[model samples]
Target: MDGWKVGVLHSQTGCLALAERGPLNGTLMAIEEINAAGGVAGRLIEPVVLDTESDENKSAELVHKLIKEESINVVFGGYTSASRKAMLPVIEKSDSLLFYPIFYEGFELSDNVFYTGACPNQYSVPLSEYLFENYGNRFYLIGSNYVFPRESNRILRDLAVQNGGTIIAEKYVPLEATKDVFKPIIQDIAKLKPDVVISTIVGDGIMDLYSAFQDAGISSDEIPIASMVTSEVEIEKMGHAAAAGHIVAASYFDTIDSPENAKFVSNYKSKFGQNMRTNMCVESAYCQVHLFAHALNITQSIDTKALRAAVLGAQFNAPQGRIRMDVENHHTHLWSRIGQIEKNGNIQIVAETKGAIEPDPYMIHHAAERWQPSLISGVAK
Candidate 1:
């Protein structure tokens, strides 16, 4: 087996770095562990990392450089949908592969990329259904001005409308906006008095938004803010009070009770530091690497065409559950779980699906169907 060089592109310094850093750390940890375990195909994996500075244009430029100049074959990284879309053309043009590790708005499929994150069906649908069931029908929507939030809100709005619910208000803010900017939005939310607030805000903007909510004397108990993007890491950074009681729908949490998760959390903390936290993106990043290793073992080459065949339908006992790549859509099946942030900066998994939920990136067809997946048998192991 010949040595395989891969590219790792992520935002190390910018608005999105708060979230992107976790995936970067997770990917590096996986590479280190794989190298320790006799390497992939007996050939040490070489990673060429490039910081995109959280800029979409920069991401595309760097990806082109990685392929044409760096001569890397397979690559992994990209936290935001904009960043991923920026690199998609480059990846496709270069005939390379990208293993994207963050959950995003679907309605997209590329032969040049493999998505290891949750799709619309895996996160948004379940979350909306849960809110509709547990909360009331009236909802307020807010998010960063971006493709992911806008698209996600579109899916959620369709689901809410189909289920006889109403979207009281919809709003958006710039990606780099601060908390002071959200004060008016918080006031509007208070006046609307919606039963739930669906927030799609990402990156550092989250800190300000959550803080603004708190300052407005709004608590999750009053009008709980539910999100598909918020994670344990965000909660930790926002402080316990700012995020407590907020509901988040995701496929993985740090508090998942399982031997595999325990080992994963332990190893991550040991490698990154005790102060560092793990979230859905981090777990997906780590799991995707192992899955890629399995694919590499089968294909024994770095060619994107061969690797795609090898990756299709590959399964790994991930920290979340048993996740398998979808042969038809190039996505991964994942377990859906709704978590509430506790005061200790940990998410308490209040509800979860029984088994792996199939990927459905294109939500255009799923709007009329029920969003709930099969219920969990009992406590998640």
Candidate 2:
């Protein structure tokens, strides 16, 4: 078959498989849709998928292989911040393009990568504001002991202090920590009686965190756990009872109302499974492919420079809405939303931006009169 070969580098197995598979599936679904619609520039997008097995070294290695060995130009993958960091040097060294489809702890940017997920300003600031307004002034920050968690918590801590709120306590546990590791933290939360728990925990370890919280008999309504991390993908693994009533700040949810979203969700479920779910990351992956196709059709070349030029100012009618790539930064403009995780792995959105919010990756531009801080410490929000 005459086609363009793109590399797929997300995990399909191992620890993060539950959440990571959704992104890979979404990428494939979009490629299939584009192919069925006569392909990009009349040639199918043939993806060469490589599973990283949730390993940082593996991520870097696979990206290198895709670029160096396979001679692929465009790739889509990387979930954890660690994986992105691990894969960066290789992505830049070869001048290949990587479409990262996850919300991250901002502060760093690359000429070789395009960020499709929400920027820190899009997810973090609005989420912090919502929590402080609806929940309470006292906050407990917790997350996995990794780049994303540490950086995410740094923003939350500052926001807590900036918003007339106080950080009661902050903590981090291992990525592979079990429920036992969170028992003590739960004890501290119970004792301190913070109004809300702002968790940035990621991967399978977060299930342990939520399970520990549930085992403690602590209800979310009384003091909810808010995060940009938890999504329908994780909730599906942890079960509705384990994940219900929690808060999630994101760019996309299956419950979003729009013809584009309705079709995206229906197509995704039809391609994957009826029991499957969608989230911010999955939607970003799906959008990235369509955007890549759009840019490819315009530029008609996989040359990184030409493709980058085409993508930098491109726009696509995405599942989240009509999103546009930032002309200055490579990140995409996206809708911001805060939703509560409901039963059956659904997210009930509580707060949302009126329209697509532009990219402010450094978190320096979208300042409120209340927030004069300039993110000088490399914090995400």
Candidate 3:
């Protein structure tokens, strides 16, 4: 809506800077397109952008200000789980809506939130199945010291063990850890010799980890690396030579071949700049804005509760593919794609799920599911 204000919360100057900028830009792009095409419901979407600075505490404060002071209707931002978690209390207390657009570990559900992103089913499960089928049954986990990476690794480890894969080494490094710090970790990994390395390290940590792995002579051809967070945005930051041959799983990529995506890419390049790259987070933000617009149009109102109700079980043909919100989990059911980072900084979708996998936030199907349905159910209540 032309006069409607939305909060754009992201880290424009911290560890998540590279990852968050794309989505923020993408959200802006969607808003611009909607405005140019006669706006949403004859209202132009105006975003009051706030910088979280990759600080969880700062994010919480910003969310409070955005909701209370700015009186923004919805917040759509944050790249890491930590930032989202930090903003949760504020959102819950204020009863404000947050459309979080990022794939994350499945163990959370909130009525005050619309997670238009992949959960475990959209990434972990499919990736685990792929590794089990193609690669041998040995794995190692590496990640930044954060809730998303830790929880993701736990789920991955459980999946690997359940699927007859063995976890040889699991390590975590602080988000700001130096490159030399990972050398010994790489040495340990080399000794343990896992068949595949599943890494969740983000930002600078990823550069260090990958560089260490390469310097230690641990090539992807020898011990392939698969990551949940590394995407076109991060790969571009790390440079092609450093990221080549690594596998990554996500719901969207810049290279997706579809008429809708082609148009999206063309429009994105034109709006953001030809040198800019698109990634899953950006696509998810774009999808979220469109979905929100659809809900508003269908209901013809911006009542938070009504919008939530309208969105709960809604499905939309997003640019990436068809996506539906899982009422039980509050996460979007989406198709997962496994892509390889080529030497040219482009992703090649090597494999994808046959259909959209339902988001299982409570992990009902897995035997060692860490979260209880009651926890998520209570949170939503």
Report the number of the highest-TM-score candidate: 1
Number of clashes in every candidate structure?
A: 0, 0, 4
Worst 10 residues of 3 by lDDT: 372-381
Candidate 3 or 2, higher TM-score: 2
Predicted structure 1, TM vs. truth: 0.96
Q: Which stretches of candidate 1 lie over 4 Å from their true place?
A: 364-381
Judged by whole-model lDDT over C-alpha atoms, candidate 2 comes out at 0.85
TM-score of every candidate: 0.96, 0.94, 0.92
Where does the lowest 10-residue lDDT sum fall in candidate 2?
A: 372-381
Residue-level lDDT tens digits of model 2 in 38-148: 998888999999989989899999988888888898999898878999999998888889999998988879999999988788888888888777788899999888777
Query: Candidate 1 lDDT, tens digit per residue, 151-180?
Result: 888888888888899999999999889878
Location of the lowest summed lDDT over 10 successive residues in candidate 1:
372-381
Model 3 regions more than 4 Å off: 367-381
Candidate 1 vs candidate 2: which has greater TM-score?
1
lDDT of 2 at 275: 86
